[model samples]
Target: MKLPHDWFHADSEDKEMYGKELNLEMLSGHFLFSKNIEVYAHRNDATDDILCRHIDAEDLYTVVHLTWSMRPEIDNKHPTVEFHGSYDEFLQYNSKFFN
Candidate 1:
């Protein structure tokens, strides 16, 4: 049988740094209007950036690096959609910080 993906065990103790248990509070606090975003990894507790996937999008595997706007506008909603690409591409993009 095929093994499960690492993300499946994201809540496990071994997955702390790279993967984490889905923090509903964090999602709600950071992304107030985003109902379609499923956050997979929260890199640092100090920052608002998170690795997530668009639940309603066609490509579920597409990893997204999102930075939520600290200040929301009265009429316009804006959050910096920094990067949208494959998981490997996401890793490569963030490799500098890890390495």
Candidate 2:
């Protein structure tokens, strides 16, 4: 999926310093499929940790935290709850949190 051109502009500096592109192959190995929505786990500049991007049927996006490894337990501090709206919303929310 293609992201907006300005999507990472705000965090470009942090991205340049610490962000790693999402590993689609590795992410696929970690998540189980569900019918309603698709989840993507990718590396981001959140303390150099991972983030999850969720896409619904209409293509709207929601982002949340994901487990660092392929383990059953998730980090409760971060929670599995999704927030933000679109890719742009995800970036905005993260820009504040990360900064």
Candidate 3:
């Protein structure tokens, strides 16, 4: 998925610094506002970025530990979430990163 302009992300600076492919081993996500939301994932066979696996939303700890690869925001209220970026760059970045 294509991320917005304000998405907050922490890429492997080492990899990017050396022009090497980043092996995204995992990602961590923490629930901030809602009880919990289930998000569906489709296995991808082709990509320009490194991705080992995809995790479900219920497994919030995975995102928290940064063990699941990229975490792009995908929610019904995504527009609202993206707009919430006004709160701060970090929140906006997180919203774009995790949603």
Candidate 4:
């Protein structure tokens, strides 16, 4: 398998680690970091319009679509660091960014 650009291959002397692929460069200015998360987002009934705008915008890599819910009862109210790269860099991270 193709490991991500920032990770090294496992070897006999290596200790196993749990992690996932993320566009690290995309997180260059952000403090948000996570792994093994299956994110789901739905458009607010205007998905088509938003998608069209993104398709036309030149910076497609950073364009992301988000739904309104994190769980069946909870909704994501504000934009976060992972979504915009630097959305939560200023928040006090408990060091989970490295784990």
Assess the local accuracy of residue 58 in candidate 3 as a C-alpha lDDT between 0 and 100.
21
Taking the candidates one at a time, how many backbone clashes does each contain? 0, 0, 14, 4
lDDT of 2 by residue, 1-99 (tens): 443332332244543332222232123323322323333333334432433444433445544444444343432333243454666666666566555
Which lDDT value does model 2 have at 96? 68
Name the regions of candidate 1 deviating beyond 4 angstroms: 1-35, 56-71, 74-77
TM-score for each model: 0.43, 0.39, 0.17, 0.19
| Most accurate candidate by lDDT | 1
Per-residue alpha-carbon lDDT of model 3 for 1-99, expressed as tens digits?
333333223355622521221222211332323323222121122222221112233223111222222433343321111111122343344455445
Q: How far is candidate 4 from the true structure (C-alpha RMSD, Å)?
A: 15.8
Q: Where in model 4 is the C-alpha error above 4 Å?
A: 1-53, 63-73, 78-99
Which residue pairs of candidate 2 clash?
none
Q: Residue 65 lDDT in model 1?
A: 37
* Alpha-carbon local distance difference test for all models: 0.42, 0.40, 0.27, 0.24
Best by TM-score: 1
Minimum summed lDDT over a 10-residue window in model 1 is located at 1-10
The predictions' CA RMSDs to the true structure, in order, are 7.8, 8.0, 14.2, 15.8
Ranking by lDDT: 1, 2, 3, 4
lDDT of 3: 0.27
Better-scoring candidate (TM-score), 1 or 2: 1
